[model samples]
Target: MSAHDFNPLLDIPVFPASGFAPLADRLKRIFATGNDLLFIQAEALLALEAAASSLGRPGLVAVNVVTSPYGTYFGAWLRRAGADVVDVVAPSGQPVATEAVAQAIEMLGHVDLVAIVHAEAANGALNPLEEVAALARAAGALLVVDAVASAGGHAVDIEGLGIDIAVLGPQKALGGPVGLSLVTVSDRAWAAMQSVPRFSPSLLSLLDIKEAWLDRGRGALPGTPPPLEFHALAAAVDRLEAEGLAARITRHQRAAKASRAGLRALGVEPWVADDDRASALVTAAPVPDGVDASALIDAAAAFGVALGRGFGDIEHRLVRLDHTGGRAAFGPVLANVTAYGAALAALGQVVDIGAGAAAVTAVYGEA
Candidate 1:
C-alpha cells in the first residue's frame, strides 16, 4: 500500500469541543450511571489524582485500600492534600479482604472518603469492589475507584455500586487511545468537593471543570481537546455498542479462564488462585524457580506472542499473560498459553505444551 492509497487513514478530522458533553452522556449510559460524569483529556491516573487532591483536605479522614501501585498513589495524593490517610495494604498478588476494610472504617470512626482500585491488571487481583463500596456507603464516606483496567472486562455499574467517584481509562479493555479518560461523580462527592475550600482551580481540579464546563451548560471543554483521542474514543464507543458490553465482558472472562486452565495444566499456578479474586484482563503467574522473567518474556516474544512484565514490587517475580482488548479471543489466548509453555521448556523447565494447548482449546470448545 502506497501513501496515496492510505491518505484517507492519515487524514484526520477535527473533534469539536462541543461534542464533549454528548460523548460524556453516551459514556454515562455505558456505565449505567445517573450521576454527573466528566471527560478529562488525560490518562485515568491523572483523573484519579485529581479526585484525591480535590476530595482530600485538612480534617478529612480517608481509608485507602492498597492493592496495587495505583492505590498507593491515591494515598499519597490524599496525604499531600492534607487528609489523614489510613492505608489498608493487602499482600502482593492478593485482593484486600472486605473484613479488613470494615475493620479500618470501624476503627476510624469517621472516614470522609475511601479509595481503591477495582482491578490490578498485571497483578491478577480484582478487589471486592461491591463489598468495599457497601462498607464505604455505610460509613457515609465517598468511595473512589480506579476502574481503568476493569471497566470493559468486567461488569461496572457505577450507580448500582454507589461509587461516589469512579475513574476509567479506555486504553486497556476498551481498546481506545490512552490520552483521554472519564470519571463519574455522585452528588454527595460534588458537595464534599465544594466544601473543600483549600482546593484551587486548576487543570486537575474537578470543581473547576464542573464550574466552568458542566455548570456553564457543558459546551466547549475548558482546554484544547485532542482531536485524535476524542475521535478514537468515539470509535471505541461505537465498537462497544455494536458488540454488546455484556458480550465483551464475557469474552474477557472466558479468556481469563482459558489462560488459567492452560497454565495450570502446564504446572504454572495462577498468581491469584481464586477465580473470584482474579482480574479478567490478564492472568499472572510467578516465574519458574531460577527463571528470569525478562528472559521468559523475551523468549515468548521470539515465538510472536507478547507477554507483559509485572509492575511495582513484583516486577521481576511475575509474568503477565495479557488477554485484554483485541487479544481477548481464542487465537490470542491459545497462543499466549502455548507460547508461555514453549518459553518455559526453552529455559529447561519441564512443561506439557501439548496439554496446555489442548486445555485452551477445550475452554473455547466448551464456550
Candidate 2:
C-alpha cells in the first residue's frame, strides 16, 4: 500500500490521455450513426440538461412529451430558457401516443423542437420514438431523445430516425459506469446550435465540444476527461459488440416478455398494460394491496435479490423489476421473480411459487 509498493492499478494510466478520441469513434459506430458523438464527464441527466440548455432559444416553439419526471424537467428547462413549450403529457404507466404528437403539431402549425424520452424506466413504458421523430421531421423541428435506458436494449438510429440529438447513458442497458454521458449530434443540430447566440461559456456547451472534435482535428478532447469511466465504457462496448446488439436486444425483449407472463401469474398488475408499450429494461408492477412495498423489497433483499425502488407518487404502491444488461440473462430473471414470489408468500399473499419461475424459463429457454 506504500507509494511505490507494486500497486496493480498503477500501470493503468489515467493521464497521458491518448485513448480518448478513438473510444469516441468506437461509440459512434455502436450508435450506428456517422454523426459527432461527445463523451461528457457526468451522468446522462446532466447530458440531457446540457442539450436542452444549449439548444433552447427565445421565440422558439417546441412540443414536449411528458411521460415521467425527466420529461417534466426537460420542459421546464426549455421554458426557463424562453422557449414557447407545448407539453403532450400521457397518463401514468403509459407512453405518449403518436397521434397525440401529430395533433399537437397540427394545432401549433409550426415548431422549432420536439423533445421526448425513448423509454421510461420509472413506470416501465416505452415511447413511440420513430413516429414522434417522423412528426418532428415533417414539421421541420429538431428532435432530442433521452435514450439512456433504451440504448443497448432497443434500436436507436439517431440520423436515420431524423433525431437532432440523441442522448445515451452506459450505466443502465450497457452495463457500464454511471459517470459518463454520450451525446450524438446530427449536422442539422450543429447548425441550429451555432446560429443561436450564447448565454455564456456554459460547461454543457455542445458547441465547444464540437469545436474540439471537428476543428481541432481528431484525437482531441476539450478539457480533462474522466479516464476511469472512459475505459469502462470501452470495455462495455467491446462486450456488447461481441454479444451483438441484435442478440442483446433480443435477450432484453425475452426478459421483458417473461417477466410480464410471470408477474401476471402472481396476481400483480403490470403498470403498463401493453407489453408493446413497456420497456425492455424494467418491468413495473404494483405491490399487492396489503403488502408494504418497503417490507417486500426488504424481503427480496434478504433472499439476495435487489429490487429497484419506485419513484414519484406511486413509490409505495409499485416495485421495479430491473432486467438490464448483465441481469437480462435467464438466471437473473428467474432469481428476481422467484424472490418476489417468495416474498409475497411470506407477506401472506396467495402466490404460486413454481409458476412465476416456470414462465421465465419457458420464454428464455425458447432458444
Model 2 gets an lDDT of 0.86
Which candidate ranks first by TM-score, i.e. highest?
Answer: 1
Question: Residue 358 lDDT in model 2?
Answer: 82
Candidate-wise lDDT, in order: 0.90, 0.86
Off by over 4 Å in 1: 1-11
Error of 2 at 13 (Å): 1.0
Q: Write the per-residue lDDT of candidate 2 for residues 1-367, one digit (tens) a residue.
A: 6677876355555733567777778878777788888888899999998898888888889999998889999999888878999999897657999999999999999899999999888878999998998889899999999999999899988878988899999998888989998898888889888866685567777887777666676565666776677778889988988988888888888889998888877766688888888999999877878889999999999999988777776778778898998989888888888888888888899888688888877887786
Give TM per candidate. Answer: 0.96, 0.95
Error of 1 at 254 (Å): 0.7
Candidate 1, number of clashes: 0
Error of 2 at 223 (Å): 1.9
Candidate 1, poorest ten consecutive residues by summed lDDT: 2-11
Candidate 1 lDDT, 1-367, residue by residue in tens = 7656746446678788678888888888887899998888898889999889888888899999998888899999999888999999999868999999999999989988889999888598999999998998899889899999999999988888889898999998998999999888999999998777654568778999898889999998877888888999999999998888899999999999999999999888888999899999999977987999999999999999988898889899888889999999999999999999999999999989999999999999998
